[model samples]
Target: MALIAIFILRKRNSDSGDRQSSNQNPQGLFSILNLEGKLVYDEIVRATNDFDAENCIGNGGHGSVYRAELPSGEVVAVKKFHSPLSCDQIADQKEFLTEVKALTETRHRNIVKFYGFCSHARHSFLVYEFLERGSLAAILSSDAAAQELDWSQRMNAIKGVADALSYLHHDCFPPIVHRDISSKNLLLDLEYEAHVADFGIAKFLMPDSSNWTEFAGTYGYVAPELAYTMKITEKCDVYSFGVLVLEVIKGKHPRDFLSSISSSSLNTDIELDEMLDPRLPAPSRSVQEKLISIMEVAFSCLNKSPESRPTMKIVSQQLRT
Candidate 1:
């Protein structure tokens, strides 16, 4: 149902060569994705053992992803659209072009690195930098992983995610709306540094128009404004980030709190230590104060009014200390 709310907001948006989607259909007419014969199709097949089950890493609405280690010893992630996705030829072609255009135009430390892709008649796949630590969702799910995720580490991850969105919203030529920002989409490196991935074919908003389509995002993390608005804005991501920040510190989803907070009748004040993840020791006073301030920013992001949310720039600045 929460994912359904994000639906009111999502609009449209995929692969290319040296890179492309690992599908068999021809991607439609976006010039950037027209690498045609240049994508590394052979390597992807060899790396995934012909799409064997062993290499499969994760699956989602867009496609099934695999963690493939190529012959060059470089580990990369490959996302292949399922055979059943009902996209028209033109849309598929455009998705491919969108991926090429966006990634080629933007460069930032927090954004995921696109390695290349293959758009084919038999299989289509997107090659992206592989992150060993996996998605933020994976870590928060495991007892061992959650235990090691401390206060400082959690803040670092927040900053990384902020930086990625900042680049997408401010540095791109026309700017890009990720349309998808949740724990599942945020991958982590060996040191657990956040690397915002899954941008092969993200949606973009016009100068002043709200782009609408079926909603896209994980449950409990989507913005409430998206529940009724088709206009995608950076504020949508801001709301999701607030949820992520709370999820990281609490060691769980903040759905219950969201439910309670939305009611607006209960007292809102609470001790910081009481809400933090019990897996780790309570933070020092300085960190605790900072966390409190950060939480304020997070809550502000949750405002029902989209315009009330802070920009990624403001969010990143608040986390720097």
Candidate 2:
């Protein structure tokens, strides 16, 4: 299998060299993927055993993520798109390009690093710096892993994500709406620090516009009002971030809890302890205060009214202090 991958990758590289010699820019679709060297692409193909299922670490709506270790001893996550461009729709192609653009253009500690990307004839994939701890959803789902994530770590993860979202919604020019913000999209490192990933559905908020578009987000994490409005806004990501905060603190999906609290009556009656995850012991006094503050901000973000939801920048600023 390894030898076969190498031969295939080498042939692909030779073919690419020939194409580059003939037409460097083929209809604006083919260009060097932000990095010099076709060797990186060849190495990645070899690293993943030609993207075999055994190398796959995770899968999402549009692609499967595989763990690849380069010859330099650095490991990376390779997301291989599944038939993303086969469709005639320009939007789908834009989404793919959007992800590449979003990652390449932005730089933040809480945002995943973009090594490079590949838009080859055989396969298309994006390479990202690997996070050892994997997705927060996977960690929180496992009792053993969840136990290792203490209150402080969980709190930091929430804050990290907030900062990242703030950078996207406020710091980035034209502003980027994640469109999809869920536990599955929040990756954790060895320290349990959160890094926002997956920008395939991200949209740029145009000036003097609502940036309205079709619904494109996870079920539970998507903002409630999006169903009626179908308008993509920064608030959509805000609502999803709120759900993530609760999920991290609670150590599980907060679907039932959210449902119960959606009614104004239950909102006031619900105790902090009741909403907290019972799997772990209650947070200490100092931690409790921060958690309380986080919960308050979270509820505000979850406001059914998009206008009522605080911007991610506000959320980030509050969490920082």
Q: Pick the candidate with the highest TM-score.
A: 2
Candidate 2 weakest lDDT stretch, 10 residues: 20-29
In order of appearance, the predictions have TM-scores of 0.82, 0.87
TM-score of 2: 0.87
Candidate 2 residue runs with Cα over 4 Å from true position: 1-34, 87-92, 208-210, 262-266
Candidate 1 lDDT score at position 1 = 5
| lDDT score, candidate 1 | 0.71
Residues 108-170 of candidate 2: C-alpha lDDT, one tens digit per residue = 999998777666656778889899999988998888898899898998999999999999989
User: Top lDDT: which candidate number?
Assistant: 2
Q: lDDT (CA) for every model shown? A: 0.71, 0.79
> 232-270 in candidate 1: lDDT tens per residue?
777888888888888888888888888877533333486
